[model samples]
Target chain A: MNSNITHDLAVPLNQEDKAKRAFVTALRVHVLQHMSGSMKNRYEDYVKPEAQKRGNTCDTPEHIHKALKSDFMFKAYSSARTCAQEMVFDVVSDSVDREFETLRAKAKPVAKKGSLTLDDSVEIPKSVSEIDVHLAPGSYHAEYTEEDFATGAVYDNAIEVFSFGQFGKDSNDIGMTLSNYVRLKFPDFKPAKILDAGCTIGHNTLPWAQTFPEAEVTAIDVAAPVLRYGHARAESMGVPVHFRQMDATAMKFEDNTFDVVFSSMFLHELPLKDIHAYLKEAYRVLKPGGLLWQMELPPMNQMPAYDNFYLNWDTYYNNEPFYGTFRRQDYRKLLTDAGFGAEEFMEATMPRYTFVGEEAYKEALSGENTFDTLTGRMDPKGTRWYGFGAWKK
Target chain B: MRRIPRKRRGERNRFFQAEGVDELLSALLRLSAEVSALKDRVYIAEKVLEQQGLNVSDAIEAYELSAEQEAELAANRQRMIETVLAQFDNSSDVDDMTDENSKIEAAA
Candidate 1:
């Protein structure tokens, strides 16, 4: 956990942009500080140990089914708090959209650089959109099988947001914010083709679209519900990227199709076999000069003691079978073996706020914001989560 | 006569995790492990019943008929397991049961 967190970016973030970030930061603190007793109890009692187990025995989909049915106290708040909104699924979607809308309205045209191509090794099964994955009844129903796709009848609109929230700060909101921040940092560094593997609902995919307007951003997932939701979302947002019901491992696109293939919080859900396949697929699909970066849980090697224990909470207990493996893996080695260039792996923590309390943010525009300008995030936007990836160009 | 349909498995977990019952909780967890293993064995035995075309009633009768009959049933189970395990030794159907059994034994 050596602090390789250095920011000597040639250009700096501005006043208004910093303010939007702080709002989310304050929101995170708001939730953490002011979560009701029942909510607090939910985490300390059920969620904490559950996370500790990495969604293990107590974390089966059946467990969720059971909890939804019988855990009276647990559901009391969930039902109350979640009635109007569709849990984490919709709330963060709204927030990210709102933030981005602000960006677009202000004429901060997201700078773009490269073109995009499809990954050839992957194929979309005709029946992929048909079978009800994990027995959710209708989420993954295919077009040819049911004519549901053409009818425009999509299912589980909120599931994408709800389940993503289960990702906590690994939330799509944080990924989009920081990813866009990266775009701003390297405006000239756009890839021809982009991929979002394990894209559930395409929230993270949307950010790439915002960042690289010209790139043919492709999002692929094995699950049909989220992919359908993502397709619908992209259409609704007026951001067109090819959304397909395809596995991240054996994508149908050609080799060297994309200049950049990235995933957000996707690698950990895969079994070890699939992870290898994905890495291979990533390598196979990327052009001779391409980049493969993923935003993932802080590797155990990159974090402190309590954080190791904290992050490994899932591996030990949560049903996330690969959390520990991913945290312990060497991305640089993984990339080099995959035939990528010397990788840049650094973690970035945005000031919770632009600099609400501190003079750093206000002073940022005045050319005085230091890398360590410790400003609190606006509200609940605690960017405790970290980002990592490798480059080929 | 509308009854509030009772829940299966209910809130017993909460009861076990409650205060002043550390030993009880430990024993329950240990027993759960035991039962979970027994379930695997039960699953295999049920499969045996299916293979033998013996329903639950027939299996019970064979298991209960006399000392000799009981021994015969036991032998049949062992043979069935041998065959099935050979075909799928790596299957969790048997080992999942055994893992839970071992946990129970260790706990006890």
Candidate 2:
């Protein structure tokens, strides 16, 4: 089933556009499932034995990448995957462009509960400005006109097609799974104020508001267009979430302000230094005894070489330049370096809350992290979401 | 009017070692997508006409375009061809073409 965005700012796509999106989604799934399996079979049948003859075990990600470089199956898989990635944005861009003015007008804030704060002086980091970051054409921060929300609309619409139903109905599975994990895992930790950093369109941010209805939720991104669009989206859904255009590395909020600082699939988009900077900022803004929680792909150390290579495919083929680098870092060291004690650091792999019901999810939390070829993949088998956090002193 | 660029900014990776193989693959995929889109549009048109109590298949087969209609359809076909082939011309900016098309659409 094709999952289309139903928000107020959603672009109206014609039948052909919908078909194109559906085709792209199917193509991506086919590549990820069938082609990936074929590539692995070719590796096991031919590439591995050849490497063994050359005295190379092909144990590292770099080795696996190099070994697969000349393989025809790998080449076909990579090319098709790249084409589908580009087409995801291309198929949705025309509809968004046609309704750009209407979407901009619709994005006007009507929220009675929350507010939008755009900082004109907030510099767009080179990581976002220079690269398209997932081959998404304009990246996250591009502005076509005054108060333009086209980028946000494009992202919100295309993500459903891109994720291929892995991100739940509203593309908020990451937030839903993580927030539920936090709430269930730490039953006594009641947060009154929450902050979501690098919250593009607030897809993941809204779940926090839903999970903890009493918490005053605030979300920040460097892009004004996305913040504006996100504000309108939250308001239309009757979920009050304060949206702000502020860099995560240098947030405008005062120190020790939030009871919970949250992020999901956000850290891999930044450079290693920026990741460190953002974590330190998260540490500073979080109140004492607060939690710094994030949902991300498991670290490289937690997986074997093949799984690492499979997960880091985005680093080589996709536009995520920092993906592999971020994964290679020691998760424990990252939190500890940012002032959280090593003893207070926590990690968990929980089943998707939306997929498996609450009871099944709660039961699955005690399960160990499963590492295989599909650990961080979009396959049905990889239903687990990895999260780690540390409690402030 | 300003148009958003459909083409992403970056160096495109060539997966195949053979010359023109990657380009051929891209063109083939584009063709497949276009074919799929066209099939869907035709299906929707047929269904809508059928729901209106019109015999779409018979009417479509029996109908003949007027001179002006034929000319318009010819121009649309040419535009579609150009749109499909524009990928080969690296100098052609998709945003610019989209802007020009929007101007034409507005004029129409």
Candidate topping lDDT: 2
Deviation (Å) of B85 in candidate 2: 21
Pull out the clashing pairs in model 2. none
Provide chain B's TM-score, model 1.
0.28
lDDT of 2 by residue, B1-108 (tens): 447787778678788888987778777777756676877898899999889987687766556557787567546544553465344222224457678989989999
Q: State the lDDT of candidate 2 residue by residue for A84-176, as single tens digits.
A: 788888888877887777777788865567889998999999999998888988787888788888788888988888888788867888899
Instruction: Give the winner by TM-score.
Output: 2
Tens digit per residue, CA lDDT, model 1, B3-107: 111111111222222453433323432233544676588778878888898767444433324567646744543333323223212223345556766898999
- Candidate 1 lDDT over residue span A277-337, tens digit each: 8888888888866767676665555454333543443443323446667767776666666
- What DockQ, between 0 and 1, does each candidate earn? 0.01, 0.20
